[model samples]
Target: MGNGISNVKPSTERSEGGEHSNSSHPHKLDQFRYKVLKAATGKFCSKNLAGQGGCSDVYKGWLGYRTATPGCGLPVAVKRIKKQGYQGLDEWNNELRILSSFHHPNVVKLLGYCAEGVHRMLVFEFMCNGSLEENLSRECCREVEWSKRMEIAKGLARGLEYLHNMDPPVIHRDIKSANILLDHDFTPKIADFGLSRFGPQGDKTHLSTRVLGTEGYFAPEYIGTGHLTLKTDVYSLGVVLLEILSGLKAVKRYPNGRRIELSQWATPYLNDKNQLHRVIDKRIIKNVDMEEAYDFATIISQCLTQDPRRRPTITQVLHSLQHIESKHQHFA
Candidate 1:
């Protein structure tokens, strides 16, 4: 098992009214009936089960491309929360409220939702490529070449920049690779907003909230004091960068029963340009340009900086990634 621990503690600080605020209004999103989703997913058959999390089960479904009616046009993912699961009605409401308010190409699209009776479900555009976590595993790493990996990184940065630059700013409390899905073209889309919240507003430097997030992805400061900041996401982004570069999970356990955190294990190599190749995944290393790999390493190091304040903004990270892509023919 990889080091994916979910600390589902909700934040104590509530966001004020704004674009990022949890509001009752769902805007333009369709209100899908439970029956519609049930039919689309074949009554949540095991064969249609795309994936399962601690809180929900995701099933593959089909809907009309234009009208979004069941069993007609495009394939979709239907996420239904289990009763007495880790995530409850509150998370369902929060995800619906937040996602409905915003739309971005790099962020997953919430096509519709169902809140009928005791059921809660969300319908999203189907991602043919699945989660980045799946693609990066040893069995599938070959599918994602170095260029695709860099593009995925850029797309994630773009998504995070969009979230962080909102009117009141938004913080994705969870920002691991598993939450990042790849479309048919391998474009990365940030998904799952059950733990998202608005960023610190006005004069506040940070929000004192419950410590929550995946274990290996949590920032030092967040884990130490439960103080949340936009940089906390940056730290997670760094862990993702390390994952992309090394083709390893944020936490990997060996046959010896020893677990190694990717960020902690790769930091020394990330800091040393000459030794940067040592941390890169061997499968893609042959085609990797040393200079480009070094540049990517530099960005990862900045994001993994011990001091949260020292981490670069998501926008800056995007610019740096774009800059690297611009100069490299290595990125196909």
Candidate 2:
């Protein structure tokens, strides 16, 4: 996060755009000084633990005070990768490579990293508000206004648009609520690039890879045929959109005792005039416009389209949400 690495030894020469000219990018990224990280994170103490996933443990830390370049210190999230086989190694390296190259306001900032021997860690700006999932929990109320929700949706759509508009178009294979972190102002930042992949180029339409994502959020086609594309991410975002609207899990229990997926259960009533409210959470519906709800639901339905090609692009989604936001602001 400070001046370009001087204390930490370089693993290899960096390319013009931060990307390695070759495929081997694991060791080519900026490595942080181990001692600095230890001091910042209190040596990975449990009290500083922010969260843990299957691949890594995230610890909250501070930096810059001792470096003599800033006031007080800046908070950072240090993700320590858990030991695993070859596949885990690849995911770790992929996250390092993808996040290092990305620079979007809605994308988590990767300040630096530590890739010494068996140790693999990534340093990112700490999000004070935690994740979207925590903010949308059952305890939440008017704090998450309808306008704020729309802003979050727009931010997420913009993040996806950035990924999809890249040279080869990167696909964030996993776009669940938990991966969307929030800043102090509640602005959403898309995190977790370990499952990200570049979409096929030229005449190729899709890449056939092992389907990997949270259950109930996977696009039907991707789950059925393992065919992945930008639309695959669109479908997952649709499920998240549904969660934002309904305040329900991607898959939840209904009174009928069947576990109804947000997509499966909400899709049928999204356009039904008499049943639209059945799927929306009651918390913010009173404050939201019905016309806007229907429009938003329509977008969600289009994103969850069974046919990937039939789904709207991330750009389209962002435009639609922004238009809605504009109307709401003018009328407010």
Candidate 3:
């Protein structure tokens, strides 16, 4: 488990229809001129800044439909690399390569890229609603109600299911809420493929790789042993679902100067149906259906199991969520 990954396989599946998915049979990726991207982002102005990562800064920009020129088509996010080191360049290339192969609705679309001189950037569809983590924060938690949370959860499951079912399969090493983007319609899209890796195939059970991901979202086994599997994503998904239900961050600092993981803090409420209310987000508490919430909690409990082998597959999780959604619709 030391980043000595090898024998990885790539996906050959093609998307039938999508905005950026309509490229070509061999996955034609757009190559954006640095000047064009700069113009689209108003010269990478601070006002257009959307996010900042350790190795890159993201700016919101608008480009032409066919030409991808400045301010004539659709809004997009431009992630510009700030570090030229090996690690930074590696992540950037990895994201570009991996995103070029994906065309799922629940996964973020890589519109194009810019690799000019010392500058390296990746362009993506700008998620209007922002990341799930941003929406769940204290300032905006109320905006995402009970139904929307369920929808987001299901969308995330679908995205993970698609990745897991790919030809060689993809393991999104980083699956935290911050990496889950939301569209104008609140459709959740899995983002940040910089740390993704191809999962084990055929006779292999798991891939031994370096452990890299958000601290709280790391699966127990992954953190301890660095064995990567599809179930690892499921465990991270459960942490995210817990955050959605409780309006809590994966890790938080308690008043006593100690930090606690959300799963450990919410275990009591998740384990006992009668105590579920104690952990429900106060902002959406009034609108939540206790029974439905309990069912959702049950699924989360199964996902958070320490034993990766015991966790339910993404498909199973999606089915359970769909069942809950159908029940809600019937009663409505």
Candidate 4:
């Protein structure tokens, strides 16, 4: 698609290598992102954009100035980082590197990137249906039918499986509902790799690093020890699965002073069929099958296992979801 950039000005000067010169200061790096945003939003107006993220605004654009096939235009999404935030050129570079390495149907495809002067931006295929967060959080939107939800979960698991089983293994340091986008058909595609990292090989149990993830989604072990592993991503995926099932925010601090994290709140109902009904989103209650609901709850339990080792591999998660989907084919 055609490239776009925002109007934000670079907060600081850029280095010869295209990265910000000030390595210690994060604010200065915001300049590069600002420039990139400006470039991405330059051609496409805000009206053409569909969404915005913590550090970027997403715009829908075209693949070429002129399409070879009429009405078959290639659609794309442009992500321009916010120049006023802590995100820097390094984060942009990391995303570019990781997305460039893999190509999977379940993973969002990185079309291209621009890292010139004080500008940094990433381009990807635009997901027409938007994020899972938008769909689940809305009260009047079309219900995420149980069969579709399972299909979405299976697609996400396959994407994560690719990341986890990669040579050296890529850990998606940030995995949440907002990062899981949906296609026109409502299939899930994993997005956002700015906080991701590649793990060590050859018997290394984990990669030690500073914890970086949404508050409630960080793995318990990673929070305690700062040890990054494939399991850490698995834990985050569990939180996402919980969100998909219960239609609750991962880190919702209720007014009752009871701070209910997804993992903590879902644990009690994980295996109890009677209690499982309480955790499901009320919107789809009448449409959901009881047996499939219990199976879905069990899958969430496996993913949210306290012991990282006990968590099912993404491959296993995919298989389980596929089984559930197969059982409910007629319902769709």
Top model number, TM-score: 3
Q: What is the lDDT of residue 269 in candidate 4?
A: 88
Which 10-residue window in model 3 sums to the lowest lDDT?
A: 1-10
Residue 305 alpha-carbon offset, candidate 2, angstroms: 1.1
Task: For residues 1-332, write the lDDT of model 3, one tens digit per residue.
Answer: 14322222234456565433323222556788998898888889888899998889999988886433455678999999885556767788788777778777899988888877677888999999999999999987447989889989999998888888776688998999999999999999999999999889789999999898888988999989989999999999999999999998999987999998999888767979889998899988999999899989989999999888899999899999999988877997
Q: Each prediction's Cα lDDT score?
A: 0.84, 0.81, 0.85, 0.75
TM-score-superior candidate, 2 or 3: 3
TM-score of every candidate: 0.88, 0.87, 0.89, 0.81
Q: List candidate 2 stretches off by more than 4 Å.
A: 1-30, 66-72, 140-142, 253-258, 328-332
Clashing residue pairs in all predictions, respectively, total 0, 0, 0, 17
lDDT of 2 by residue, 115-161 (tens): 66567788998998998888877875436887788889999998788
- Candidate 4: list runs displaced more than 4 Å: 1-44, 66-73, 84-86, 255-258, 326-332
Residue pairs whose backbone atoms clash in candidate 1 = none
Model 3: clashing residue pairs?
A: none
Query: Which 10-residue span in candidate 2 carries the lowest summed lDDT?
Result: 18-27
Query: By the lDDT metric, which is better: model 1 or model 4?
Result: 1
- Quick one: ranking by lDDT, best first? 3, 1, 2, 4
- Superpose all Cα atoms of candidate 3 onto the true structure and report the RMSD in Å to 1 decimal: 4.6
